[model samples]
Target: MLAIDGSFLDFKQLDLLALRQTPVHRLDPRAKVLTTLCFIICVVSFDRYQISAMLPFLIYPAVLMAVGDLPFGYIMRKIVIVIPFALMIGLFNPIFDRQVLMQIGSLDIWGGWISCISILIRAILTASAAIILVAITGFPAICEALEKLKMPQTFAVQLLFLYRYIFVLTDEGVRTARARQLRTFGKRGLGIRHFGSLVGHLLLRTWERAERIHMAMLARGFAGEIHSTRRQSHFGRTELLFMGGWISLFILLRLYNAPQLLGGLFTGTMP
Candidate 1:
């Protein structure tokens, strides 16, 4: 019960972080969204064996978190939770690709190992960028930005609804689980046999609750469009500079391995 409730709180905390009055938070959402999109594209564009070249991308998220005043530990924990999926996706690379890619002294490093590490690094960088985007911009503003960026209204509305109702669904699940625990004694009805019934109850309860919410929204003049109380800011010079500068840097990093070049220069091996 506590785990479920805690997870819900953690999920909602991003909105709370977005409420802070930081420079990053004050920028137009479209600028941040575009910059983050470019960052993800650059991070994923690296070759499978390319690792060091991607390390510099970490600077984007780190700088954003600092300027946005987001809590590093909280964001790191959220990133860590989804890492296992990336790990599982690349776990078998070593078994199938045994060809050696590099030699370090006596030990041989295989292509699979390098690719696996590359996948993990890409996952971390992309996940951190996305989490920081939400922590600073909030989901509503992101959806609004997407709508302005030519994303279909229906798609944007559905996406926003999905994000919003996730909390409701999680809350419903928690209540159902608690009710099950209370009615049973000493794990009598807590077995896997009752799992299906508990899920069924949760679904019914959630459906009814969703109907109520929809009715309330309709009564309050919700006409398939989300409105915000915050004043909408124009995409001004600051936004242009913010997006342009980061995009230029992303292109530079994508084209050249700065780390490798610096290492060569330092070792008098520049060619």
Candidate 2:
């Protein structure tokens, strides 16, 4: 019963944070990763005062979040944690660039603030998209995606192996600690010397396991690369149409007049 309960708990937690099985997840990891990179590049390429231009770019991330069924609040919270880093770098702009680029009656709007806001928006969009991508795609898919993208075969394979064995290693460490606890009884747990010894033992065990796995792989002809038999994924017409329509619309708004369009929409000229 205890074992069953533990397994159930682990399964539930994994579902809460683990990757979902959906169309987005089934997409070729390499392609999805590349598209995400392109999206971020497009967003960052816009100059300051590009709020309207950024709107259409928002569609890509939004559709991914919605269709992917990702945990939006969890991803947004991660974004909030990283906001302080951006704020630290951008806060200097207001002090350094004192010249006002625009004015509205008594309020002097500095170019620094505009640039800072631009930086903040780009940072948020890029980070949020990245977190969502990883959350929806899982670590193995990411490693596989990297592998398929012509990344160094050795490096990508190492990541794949590392992720696969991490949990096993962790479980071994936990069991060892429990055994130590049972033996120590009233003794101080995890003292410096004891901790050092435990770490050394864990390292030796991990090395031995790796060696055994390598030998097993050699026996089966690893051939210096890991191979997966999963079918390749491709984007359909719907995805292409969505990407094209949004890219063209955003570029048009950016080149023409973004702020005017936004103002007109707010003022009821266009929805």
TM-score of 2: 0.65
Winner by TM-score:
1
lDDT: worst 10-residue window of model 2: 7-16
lDDT of 2 at 251: 61
lDDT of every predicted structure (CA atoms): 0.90, 0.73
lDDT of 1 by residue, 1-271 (tens): 8976897789988899999999999999999999999999999988999999999888899999999988989999999977999999889998888999999999999898889999999999999999999999999899889988999888888888899889878887888787888888657785887998888888888789879988999999999876666457789999999999999999999999989998999998974
Model 1, position 155: C-alpha lDDT score: 86
- In candidate 2, the residue pairs with backbone N, CA or C atoms under 3 Å apart (3 or more residues apart, or in different chains) clash, namely none
Q: Write the residue-wise lDDT of candidate 2 on 131-161 in tens digits.
A: 7767666666777777777888788888878
At residue 208, give the lDDT of candidate 2.
100
Deviation (Å) of 244 in candidate 2: 3.5
